[model samples]
Target: MRDNYREELDDIRGCLVDMANSVGSQLSKATTALLDADVTLADLVIAADDQLDATRESIEQRCFTLLARQAPVATELRTVITAMRIASDFERMGDLAEHVAKVARMRFPDSAVPQEVRPVFLEAGHVAESLVTKAGTVIAKQDVEAALELEEDDDAMDRLHRQLFREVLSEDWPHGVETAIDITLLGRYYERFADHAVSVARRVVYLVTGEHRINAAG
Candidate 1:
């Protein structure tokens, strides 16, 4: 019986890792399209999001099966609940990637962001990607410390988001109102992605330590 429970836990972890990889690839491709103005890559990001949706459903179904069949307790129950929570976060991340791809497709010949702001976008994307990847590691390794560190990494994305808005809204910036809106929206997408990643990390910390971390209340 113990061995059977262990097997189920392993299955849950495997499914989660697969889901994380799918969402991470979506984020990476979306970032590439935004940075290079690659319409093809944007299209690919849009198409790939469907796979993540399917993966989420598959994981959710497996979790439900385990709950019904095994009747998990304590840590096992927590693991299954965490799996569900993380899957939802990954799905939301995929949606945010699609939003970015939409912005890329919106401006065909020109990129949504100005050349000057490209670096900021790239940095935010990197931070957001790092957050997701790190959350995956925490899940696999059950590393509470690494999960805690995600909050600090999220700060960089927040700073860059603010910097992007400040520059776009500056009177001297020359791209006009339309350009400002695009960049503002793009920055927001990246920021929100990072925010969701942080949310996942907090759940990981809770699962490991059994104490909820401090975060903004809904």
Candidate 2:
């Protein structure tokens, strides 16, 4: 029975990694759709979110069953708990990406985004996609060092988000108020997406070091 439990635990870890990859793909596509103003791609991102949602649910169910059956202790306990937490974070990341895709689909033909602000949005999208991809790597490899680097990359997205807002507000008379609002929300979505990826990376650091590096980072 112990052997069976051990196998199940490994399976759970694999499932979590799979879930992370799924979320990463969704985020990448969603951001791409938004940047390219590809409504069809945006629609695909929205549709694909359902699969991510299902994957997370399956992972959570297995985690729960393992806890109930094995009553895991020590490292096993830590593994199960971390898997649950990680899956939840990945699910939220998927939701945020879907939200960005929605923005693309809704604002197409005349994207609410101003021509001048396009560069900022593009930069934010690129950084956000990179962060999510790196996050998947850290989760799969348990590379605490790589996870630490992701925290710094997150700063670029934050800076771009702030600049976008500043530009929007500074304009004495903005064109297409609706488009401005959509772009503002879209920028914020990307910022928050990176923030969640950082959260996942922080969890990886803790899982590897048993120390919460989030607060320790100065």
Candidate 3:
């Protein structure tokens, strides 16, 4: 019976890793849809978010089931709790990607990003993708070193986010109110996406260390 309980805990960890991979894909595909101005692809990305939501719900339910039946203690309890938290982060990450795709769909047929600032969003997308991918690996391996490295990796996304604000607030800005608003929201979406990835990494760190704290950098 204890062996079975341990197996369930391992499966929950696996589910978190799988959810992270799906979220990473959503971020990448949303970025492509945004850059390409392809509403069709954007629509596909939007539709696929349902799967992310469903997967997270399943993970959360498993957490509850483990708590009720297995009564995990100490590190094992931390494992279940952190799995729920990480699942929430993954769900939020998916929502952020959907928001980006919705932005792309909103400005369909023409790029939502202005030419001058396109590179910023592109780089932001890449950084988000990189961070979440790293977060997934950290969860799967529970590597404290790589988990800690997520904080440093998030710096790239933060820099790009600041650059975006500078562009939006510049005296020479010429994209008009609509584009500026879109840029502002996109900047936020990407920033939050990176934060969610960092959150998952931090949880993994806690699972390993029993620290149970959010990262300071975030």
Candidate 4:
């Protein structure tokens, strides 16, 4: 019975890793849809978010079941609880990516991003993708070093976000009101997506070492 319970815990962990991977893939496609203004692809991304929702729900159910049945202690308790928290973050990440796809779909034929700032958003997308993938690996291995490094990776996204503000706020900006709103919203979605991934990594660090590291920004 004890051996079976341990296997169940491992299965729950596996589910969380798969959830992270799915969110990362969705983010990649969502960014492509945003940059190219592909409404069809955007629509696909938006609709598929339900998959993430289901994954999170399944994870939560398993976690609660463990808490009720096994009464997991110490690291085992942390494992169940942190899986729930990380799964929530994973679900929110999906929602952020969906927000980006919605903006791309709303603009339809016209690209949501103007040509001048196209490179900035493209870079944002790249960084967001990299952060989530790295976050997943940290969870899989519970590597405190890798988990700590996510903050630095997130810094690159922050720099790009501020760069976006400079572009939009400039007096000579040509995109005007509607494009400005799109760009602002798009930038936020990317930034928040990365933030959620960072949160997940922090939780993983806490689960492994029992110390929740403070974020420099916080």
lDDT of 2 by residue, 63-89 (tens): 999999889888778888888888888
Q: After superposition, how far is residue 112 of candidate 2 from its true place, in Å?
A: 3.2
In candidate 3, the residue pairs with backbone N, CA or C atoms under 3 Å apart (3 or more residues apart, or in different chains) clash, namely none
Model 4: runs farther than 4 Å from truth? 214-218
For residue 1, model 2's alpha carbon misses the true position, in angstroms, by 3.3
Off by over 4 Å in 1: 214-218
In model 2, which runs have C-alpha deviations exceeding 4 angstroms? Answer: 216-218
The local distance difference test score of model 3 is 0.88
TM-score of each: 0.95, 0.91, 0.96, 0.97
lDDT of 3 at 71: 85
Error of 2 at 18 (Å): 2.4
Q: Give the distance in Å from residue 144's predicted Cα in candidate 4 to where it truly belongs.
A: 0.8
RMSD of each: 1.5, 2.2, 1.3, 1.2
Best by TM-score: 4
TM-score of model 2 vs. true structure: 0.91
The runs of at least 3 residues in candidate 3 whose Cα sits more than 4 Å from the true structure, single-residue gaps closed, are: 212-214
Candidates sorted by lDDT, descending order?
4, 3, 1, 2
TM-score of 4: 0.97
Error of 1 at 98 (Å): 1.0
For each of the candidates, give the backbone clash count: 0, 1, 0, 0
